[model samples]
Target chain A: MDHSSKRGDRPGVSRRDFLRGTGAAATAVASLVKVPGVEAQEAKSGADVVAIGPGPVKLSLEVNGTTMTTNVEPRVTLLDALRNYLDVTGCKKVCDRGTCGACTVMVDGKPIYSCTMLALEAEGKKIRTAESLIDGGKLDPVPAAFVACDAQQCGFCTPGFVVAMRAVLDANPKATPAEVEKGLAGNICRCGTYEQMRHAIEDLCKAGGK
Target chain B: MDNFVYYRPKTAEAAVGLLDAKWGTAELLAGGTDLVSLQKQYIARPKKVISLSQVQGLDQIEQSRGWPMTFKIGAGVKLATLAASSALRGSAAALAQAAEEIAGPQIRNMATLGGSLCQRNRCWYFRDEQSPCLLKGGDKCFALDGENRYHAIFTQGRKCVIASPSTVATPLMVLGAIAQVLSPKGKREIPLAEFFKAPTGPEDREHVLAPDEMLLSVSFSIASDKVKSASYEVRQKLSSDWPLVQASVAFELDGGTAKNVRIALGHVAPVPMLSAEAAKAIEGKPINEETAAAAGEAATSGAKPLSQNGYKVRLLAVAVKRALLTAAGAKKYWEV
Candidate 1:
C-alpha cells in the first residue's frame, strides 16, 4: 500500500496560519491584551520558568525523526496537532478521551494516547506515529502479521494496533501471545475483530520463534 | 476546552506561587490525562494552568537506608514505572499490584501517582455537564433517586454518593503512606488516611489540599520480611474498566496467628474506608476459610446500599476475604 499518498489531501495553508488570521479579526472587535516579555519576567524569578499565551504559540516537535514546527494554543492536544496541522494522520481520533487507544503514539519509546496529552508538553521529546511503522516503503513484520490473519474490518483501529504491537515487540522481541494481549489491552475495536486479532498474535509468536 | 495561559515552572515554589488563594482560579497540570478531559467537558475552567512537567527531580523514586527501609516516591512518577519497579515489587507488592490493575497500558503510561489520587469522582450525574448535581453546587444529588448502580454504598449521609475512584488509595492507606505537601508558607506531611475526605459542600474538593498547595511526594516505610501484604480487585471487565470492589490487606504472621492486621476497602465509600471490625475478626487468629469469611462479613457491617447497588455489598465482602487469604498465602478456595 502507498501510505505516503495520504498526505496529498492536506490543505496548503496550515491550520495555525488560518486561525491566526481569524484571531486577529476577532481581536479587533474585542480588544484582548497580548502581553509581551512575559517569558523574561518569569525567567528572572527562575531560570527555567516560562509562560506562553492564551492565543497561538510556536511549538517545535520531533515526530518520526523529523523536527516539525507549528503554532497552536495550549489547549490543543497532540493528536490534533499531528492530524490537523502536521498532516500526519495515521493515528485516528476515534475516542478523544484516553479510554480508546485509536490515537496511540510512542512518545519517548512509550505508547500513550495522543488525545490526552497537550502538544506543548511534547516539546523536546522524540515522538513516533503509526506512519513510522513502514520502513523503506515496506510494512513492518507486526503489520504484516495483521494482513496475514485479516485482523481488521473497518480498519479505523489498525494503525494503533500495529504501533502498539510493534512497541511490545521492540521492548521484548520474544514476547509471548499472552504478553502481547496484555500490552495491547488499551486498544478497542467496535467491529469485534478480536478473534482474528488473536490469530494474528499466534502467527507473530510463531514467526518470532525463527 | 477554553483557552488558558500556560506556565511551566522550574521549581515547586514557583509553581505554588502562581496559584491563587481562592479555588478554581489556577489549576495544576500533572500528566493531563484527567485534567484535559475535565476541561473539554467544561467541568474545570481554570484561567491559568501551571505545568509541573518541567520541574526537576519530581519523577524520581528513591529508597533511603535505615533501621526500617523507607521509600519516597515523587508525585510525578508515572504509574507504569510504579508497576514495573523491582524495588516496589519486593518491598510493597500490594501497591505494585494495585498500580498494575488501574486503567490500561496507554493510560498507565501517561497517568501519574498524584493525578490518580486527586482525580474527581466518576459518578454519571456529576460527570454530565447539564445535570445540576450536588457536587457541582446544585441543590440535590441525582444519584440518590436516579440510576445509581455505580454509586457509593457507604455514603455516611454526606449528600454526594460518588465512590472514590483511586485504586491505589486502598493499598496506600493499608501501607500507612504519608503525603508531603508544599505551599507558599512551608511544607507539611499529612497521613494518607486524613488526606482523603468526602466533599461536604458545593465548594469542597475530594482531597484536603488547598488551592495554593501542591503534593510534592509520598513517603512510606517498606514492609519487613515478616509482613504479608496483598491486593485484590473485582471488575466487570479486565480491560480499562474501574473496579467494582477492591480490598488491600497487610498483617504480620507470628507463627500461625495473624497480628497487627490492617484492612482497607475501595469503590464502596466516599473515601477509602478502613474497617476496624474487619481487622478485629482476623486478628490473633489463624487465617483460614472460617476466619477469612468472618472478616469479609464484618467489612460490610455498616454498608447502606443504595437502590441499585446492593450487589456491591456482597462483592466487597468477597474481595476482603480473598485479599486476606492471599496475604496469608493460603489456598485459593474460589479457584476450586
Candidate 2:
C-alpha cells in the first residue's frame, strides 16, 4: 500500500529504483562481478586483494615524491602509463623490448627499464623519472653538463641518458673513466655522441655532481 | 603485444597457486627483461601473467660459513646487483664476471639469475613467431638449414638447432650450482646440468620446469682455497651483445700444476656444454700455455659445426684456453 514510503525510509535507496523495480536494483549489484579479467579477490580489501586485470584498475604511485593516482590496464607498461596517462613523457620509448635504455627510470632507487615493467608491479615503489631532474626551472647537473658538452645531437636519447647518468654518479661519486664507461654502457646515442657523453659525465664528476 | 591479465602475488606460495589455478594459460613474470620482448614479438602470449615483483625478501645474497662454504643467491636479485656484490665477487668470482658480462648495464639492471637461466633460446627463426620452427611445434627447424650461423654446433642430438643463451649458466655449471625450485605441490632442487634440458622434440622447452613451478634460488659451494676460477666470453661487441662463445674454468691448483679442473662452454651447444675431455687434458699437468692449448684443443674435439658457424669451434677453443690461463694466473693469450 505504501511501498514507496517504506523504500524511502530505507537509507541509500534511490528514488529512481521505485520506478525500475528491485530486479533492476539486484542486477546493478550483480554487475560488479561482470568486470572482465578481474579475479574474484578484486572485490576484497587488504593483502588478499589480487587485482588480475586486462581491464583498468586504480593505482596509487609515489612519483618524484608526489602521490599520483591513475587507472591503467594490467597489460600497460609503466613507461606507457607515465607518458600516456600521467603526462610524464620525459622517459623516451625506444626498443621497448628492454634492450635500449631509452625508457630507464629509477624504481625504488634503482634504475630499471620502465618499458619492460608493468605499472601494477611498480605500485608501491618510489618511481623517479627523467622529469624529476629539473628543480626551480634549472636542469640537474648531469643534464646541464649534457647540454654544455653537446652530448646529444638528435636529442631523442637525452632523457634516458640523463636519468641513467644520475643513477651512475649517485652510486659512485668519484667514478673513474672505466667505471663511467661501464655505468653509461646501458644508454646509447645513435648519433655517435658517446665521446661527448663521456665528456659531459666527466664534467659532472668534476663538479661533484652538484 | 597482446593484452593479458596480470597478477602480483606477494608470496611464492600465492604466485605458485595462481600458476596452478591458471594452469596452461599462465606465465610467471620476473624481471620481464626477456619476457616483455618475447611478448612483444608474440613469441610468448600467455592469457594470464603472474608477476613475482611483490615477492619480497628473495633478493638477499647470503654466504654461509661451512666446510665447503655455500652461497645462496636469491632468484629475485638483479644481475647488476649480483655482478657488483663484493661478497660474490670475492668468493664466486666467475659467477660475478659472468653476471657482469651479460648484455649491458640496463638489461642487467632488470635481469635476474632465474630469468637468465630460464630464458628461451635466441634462435632468430624461433623468435620470429612466423617461422614455425621445430622448437615451436612446427614440422621443421628453419635454423637447421636457413641462416644456421648462430645455431648450435653441438645440439645434443636434438632436432632444435637453438643454443643456450644464458651467460650465467656457463659459470654456474662449472661451479656445480643447484637450483631450488618451488611448485604448488612441493619443492625440489635440481643441479644446473639437470636444470637445463636439451630440446628433445618440437614441444620441448629449453628447461624442464613445469608450468606450475618457479626457480626459487640458486646455491653453489664456494671455490675451495686450492681453486681459482674465471669466466671469459667472446661477444661480438664489447658494449651489449650476446657472446659468440663463452667459457668458464675452475682449476684446483697444487703448487703450479692443475690437480683437477672443470670447464664449461656456452653458445656451442643446446645446454651449457661441460667438456670432460677438456678437463681431462689438463689434469695433473702444469698450468702453462701448452697445457691450456691442449685443453682448448680437447674442448672442440667433438664439435659438429653448422655451415655458417664453423668459426664458433675455434672461438670456443680460444675461450677455453684463455679462461684456463686466466684462472691459473698465467699470462693470458690472444691479448693482442
Candidate 3:
C-alpha cells in the first residue's frame, strides 16, 4: 500500500534509526526486511489470508508527523510498537487491557486505547500521542494547563489524561462540567487527582484552551 | 502473546475468505478492544489475524425516513459515535443510552457494535487461562461452584454461568433489530431474538455466527408514535465498570394505557432475555405506579439464581421497573 503519499515525509528519520531507538535487536530487524515478499503474496492474492508466522514482517506507521518503517510481529500492539519501536514512550502502559486509559492516544482525531490496537492496523492512519504535544521544548496548552492546576500526583497517568483533555477541548472548547466528566471517564488516577483535573479542565474551558 | 500472521484486507470478501472452519485458523480483527485482550489472555490464539480496518463502507450509519423509519448501522461503527449521534437519540434512544453507558470513553471510541456483541462472557474462570471451564472443553464450569456472584440468574447451571455482557444487546433486542450476516455461502438476515442461543453443549457458542461469517450491519426501525423506548443500567460505579443489572423497555401506549410492551434484561442470564411475563402483565393496563411496580415484580417469575447471585433477582426487578417507567415518560421517576 502507498502509505507515504497520504502524509508528507521527513528526511532525517531513517527506519534503522527508529528501530534502534525502539531497542530492537539488529538481527531481528534484518530478518523482518526479508520476509515481506512471501507474506505479501499470501495476504494480497486469493489464497488463504490466515497464514501462520512466527517471524517479523516489514510494517510502517504514520506517527506524530512522520512515517517510520520497522519490522515487528503481527502480535505487537500499537502501544508496544510506539514505546518499543519508535521510542515514543509518552503514552504510558498500565493495565495492558482496555480498562485503564493510561495508553490513550488519538487515531484520526479520535481517542482510543492504544494497548488494544494492533500496530499493523495503524499502518496509514494519523496517530497523535502525548509525545506530540511537546513541540520544540514547549508544552502544549493542555499539558501546560495540567501543570498549572497541579492535576497529577504520581505522574504515571498524566500523559493519557493530557491527551484525553486535548481531545475533549479540541472537540468542545466550551465543554460543560458534565461533558468533561463524561469525556474523561475512561482514565483513572490512582492518586485521586480527579478534583484537580476537573479544575484544570474547567480552567481550560474558561480560557478557550488558551 | 502468540505470533500470528496479520492480514489487512481492503475488501469485505477478502476478509471473510480468510476464515476457516478450524477454531484458531483465522479471526476477524474489528475494533480490537475485545479481540486483543482475548489474545493477551491466551483465550484466543489465532494463527492468522485478519484486520477489517481497510474494508470500506462498514463504518457509516445510514438512516431511512420513510415508513417504518430505520437506522442501518454498520457493524464497524464506533460505539462513541453511535452513542453521541443525534439521529439515534430521536428514534432509537435506548440504543444510544446503552452505547453511552458502555465501558469508558476510550473504549467506546474503539469498540464496535459487532465486537461488543461477539465478545465472550467475562466469567473469571472463562477468562483465566488456568481454569479449564466447560466452555473450554472442560468437564465442569468453575463459576457453578466458585465465585458465583456474577453468574446468571435466569439460565443458571445449564452449561455456563456467565451472563451476556453486551450492554447494546439488551436494547437491540427490545427494538426488534435484525442482524445482516455475510457468510462465504451467502448473505442472510436474522432477527436479534434468534441471534443469540443458550449453550446446549460443550462445543456450542453464544451467537449463531459461523466461523466464516461476518456481521455486516444491524438494522432496526422506530416508527410508531405510540411506542416509547428507554434503557436503564445500574452499575457498581459511575466510572467504566460492567453493569450489575441492565433493563430496556419499549411500551406501546394508547392514551396512557399500555397496549403492548417489550421488556428485556441483561447481565442476569446467559443471553439478553425478553421478559414475556412482565410484558404480559402490563398489557392493556394503565401505566401507573401500581401497575409498573406489579410488572416489575412479575418480571422475576422464572429466575433461578445460583447460590450467591440471588441478590441479582431484586436488582433485576428494580431495573425493569425503572426502565419501564422511563419508557412510559413518567415524570420524577428517577427521584423515587
Model 3 C-alpha lDDT per residue in residues B1-336, reported as the tens digit of each score: 766767767778888887887555678889998889989999887777888887889999999866578889999999998899998887778899899999998999889998888877888988898988888888887877789898798864477778888999989998989999988988999998888876644456678888888999999887676678888888889869998889998877787788758888898888888999999999888877788888888989989988898988898888888887777778745684
Clashing pairs in 2: none
Residue B59 lDDT, candidate 3, scale 0-100: 94
Task: Name the lDDT value of residue B242 in candidate 3.
Answer: 92
Question: On lDDT, who's better, 1 or 2?
Answer: 1
- Distance from true position, residue A158, model 1, in Å? 1.0
Write candidate 1's Cα lDDT for A1-210 as tens digits: 645645456657666567656655653432343334243332233465787766677889999999999777777799988987787889999889888899999999899999999999999999999899878989888888788889999999989988888888888889999999999999999999999999999988878822
Model 2 segments more than 4 A misplaced = A1-49, B20-24, B200-202, B333-336
Residues B241-283 of candidate 2 have per-residue lDDT tens digits of 8988999988778878887688999988888878999999998
Candidate 1 lDDT, B111-156, residue by residue in tens: 9999988888888887778997888888998988889898799866
Model with the higher lDDT, candidate 2 or 3:
3
lDDT of 2: 0.81
Query: Considering lDDT, where higher is better, how would the candidates rank from best to worst?
Result: 1, 3, 2
TM-score (C-alpha, index-matched) for candidate 2:
0.89
* Model 3 Cα shift for residue A10 (angstroms): 35
DockQ of 2: 0.34
Model 1 alpha-carbon drift over 4 Å, by segment: A1-48
